[model samples]
Target: MSSVLYQSVVKNYGALNVLRSLDLAVPDHMFLALLGPSGCGKTTALRILAGLDMPSAGKLFIGERDVTRLQPRDRDIAMVFQSYALYPQMTVGENIGYPLWIRGMPDAERRAKIDEVAAVLEIGHLLDRRPRQLSGGQRQRVALARAIVRDPAAFLMDEPLSNLDARLRLTMRGEIKRLCQRLGATTLYVTHDQVEALTMADFVAVMHGGELQQMAPPADIYDRPANRFVATFVGNPPMNILPVTLAEQGIAIGGTPVAIPAARLAACRAAQVVEIGLRPEDMSVSVPGAPNALPGEIYVVEPMGNETLVNVRLGGGNVSVRAGRDFRGAVGANIAVTFDVSNACFFNSAGLTAVHRVNSDGE
Candidate 1:
């Protein structure tokens, strides 16, 4: 296994800059996901690393070797595409063994390697079938087997689960995570799915507008986003953002004073905080006129089985609150929402995180 590095990598197409001096590092045997929406340069970065596309400037490295100008074949990396790029006419065994065969491995050894990889992916029984004969999951397994048979320095996966059905996607997510762990391989995965990035990767690099937004572990990415873009992008319901005015006591959201810790308040004051962010799970339905509560009307209620998502229309904005499954409230009903000020995130006028609440108890 080998580490991967991108040193000030930039990709420009005419007047459009695709990647803006991106610098990233994937530690040896680490699984890093390049996560972003469409047109966010994630796929471009992966392609540049795989030698399928060249960067306009800067260097790329696999381990200690600079592979900036190397051909794809010489880069010593295996890619699993989103489409499961398997040979239509060739049997599963032939597809998996193709890499070894091209490298001049003996027929017997190539067959053995194919069998070994196929068994590991649990597709050994389908080796004789062509691509059209197998189900989507089985075909994906075959593609994985083909990549694994090469035993390259790093594995590059580009949305390998996007084509599968929802249930199959869930199963394959676990399978891919387990497979990577077992091999202890260096992996760089590119995807737009936040769930996939958060669940499978050791580190997630969130990108937007051809620039790196944040790179952190899953929990940190969700709990302590770097800026407004990251804070609003990574969450499911997304964090609730409200405009706030600085006050002598603390801050005021929609003209309602909210108490905050002295130190945190000072930091926010120093940074000239203009907004506060609270996650859906951080706020709860509270009694009307309660301390540190914002009076609002119920905008909507969604029964999510395990929990009810309540959207309340406050003076500042609509905020989603995670309530108990048994929560029952009428639309337009008067209500109050309260949250821990210590758990709030303060943002500056420039949209950067001014101060973030650290989960000290590790909740």
Candidate 2:
């Protein structure tokens, strides 16, 4: 149970820079996910924390102790890689007890610790099975049991479930989250999968181009993205970003009128053109006469069993709207769409920073 912190961590390989002054902290017993695409420096940052890669500059700490110059073994951290890394010749019990054995624990004590971790991981029944005799999930459990057997100060995991099937990944997600909660160990997870980060971590640090983009809880990152890149990345269907003109009469969407409040209009006075963000589920299709509605033509309709996703063409771009399962709108049909003022996100024309939202009554 230790907190992890990195300050001004910079990593460079020759002339190419991988991380730019990266600073992050995770509280004791908290799970933080370092989430981004490949080449985003997330894996590099994880390796630096694990003491597997040395930072070109900056400081690293585990619980109040500055460990920038510490070796991997001296950092008191356990790491789990994507490949499982289990020895084919070793049985499950042997694999789980190897860490204790290498640390010079007595045979009886090593076996007791192995039995304890195996029972906690629910792999006690498979103690005698080799890696070849176990399923992928079972093998992964064995790998995790080995890591936790020593009770290290923290755990560093690099896409540990990336090789599993979708169903298995979902199951493992729950298992991993439960295991961390039960152990109360500070954990750092690196992955490109947004679902894994959102479903498992206490907080998510979104990164891009070796820079920290946004660090927030999953719901805030989804509802109020700091920038356009985050807005488009975190959601499944993604948020629809459309260009609109801010005016006293409200915003103009494809030559049609959509009324925004005077307060919001005042808040966005710096730009004549602003980018408005709307989530697929936030917009609804209606008849053409609703007040504050923007007229559009449906280009496609996809029935998703539980609901329907309607792609409507507004001018040259298309906007996706999530509708009820019973929605029967067809392509080529004219429809009006409206969204709640409070639910929409505003951004400057460049879509760099999130614009502030002010409601009606000039408040």
Candidate 3:
């Protein structure tokens, strides 16, 4: 496993600009998720790294070696695609051991490596089965086993869990993260699901419209998004961004006085209009005596066993607050939600973020 760096990478298909000049780095042995919507070029970026696609313009480096012109096989990388991409004619054992065999490893070593990975991946019992005989999750496990057995420079996974059911996807997310960490395999994974990105990767790169929106640790991306897009895209049920105005002294939501700390207010003097980003989990169903509460009416309640999400309509927009499982708010109920000041984010109307600046390491 090695450091993967993409410098000034660009990809275009005739008039469609799939990837604008992009620069990203996956440090040695760190799992990084290329996360974004379907057409945001995350898959393209993985293909470029895997040598399946050539960049229109850029320099790509795998560790200290430049591999911009290398073929897929020439680069020491194994990829697991969303489709599993198993050889239908081959049994699971054969598919998992194929990479080692092709690299001309001794038969005994290949068998040993395949057995080791198959055992760890819990796919040993399925080894004798063909792809058609195995279930979706089992086939995916085989694909991952093959990639792991290769002992390649890096593993590239492009939405490898997308085809599985929710439970299987969740199961594989933990498996992949644990497997990568145990082997210390530098991995670049691509997925549109924010949960997959946040859960499996040490670092997450959020992309939009063929551009890298922000790159940071998952916690940072969730707590301090670089922009409105990243804020809205990173969290579950999405972070709520309310359009507000900033005066020289304080902030106002819908022309009503909202108490913002003096220091934060001063920091926002430059932006006349801004959006306050609040994660659903950061806002509570205003506990008994909490102040700085925003008034709203309950619009919807969603219960997921462990928690209840209460969507409330503010004057202009709406925000969702994550309530405890015991919370029993009825629809159309009057409520006041309180945002945790220290945990909230703010961005100017231009969409560039401001909250990440206040408590940065500079603090």
Candidate with maximal lDDT:
1
Identify the candidate with maximal TM-score: 1
Off by over 4 Å in 2: 270-273, 356-363
Task: Please write out the lDDT profile of model 3 over residues 1-363, one tens digit for every residue.
Answer: 789999999999999999999999888999999999889999999999999889999999999999999988989999999899999999999999898888798999888888899999888888888999999999999999988887788999999999999998888899889889999999999999999999888999999999999999998888778888888888789988787777655677756557877776776665543777777888888743356777778999999899999999887598988999999988998888887566667787679986553454545
lDDT of 1 at 82: 91
TM-score of 2: 0.94
CA error at residue 52 for candidate 3, angstroms: 1.2
Candidate-wise lDDT, in order: 0.94, 0.87, 0.87
Candidate 2, residues 1-363, lDDT tens digits: the string is 799998999999999899999989888998999999899999999999989899999999999889999999888999888889998899999998887888899999889899999999999999999999999899999999999999888999999999898999998999999999989989999999998998999989999989898988887777768888888888879889888776667777677767766766666665544788888988998888788877889999999999999999886279999999999987899997888866777778676645633324443
Off by over 4 Å in 3: 287-291, 357-363
| Top-down TM-score ranking | 1, 2, 3
Candidate 1 vs candidate 2: which has greater TM-score?
Answer: 1
Error of 1 at 230 (Å): 0.9
Report clash pairs, candidate 2: none
lDDT of 1 by residue, 8-45 (tens): 99999999999999999899999999999999999999
Q: Please say which candidate is ahead in TM-score: 1 or 3.
A: 1
> Cα miss at 127, model 1 (Å)?
0.7
Q: Give residue 137's lDDT in candidate 2 (0 to 100).
A: 91
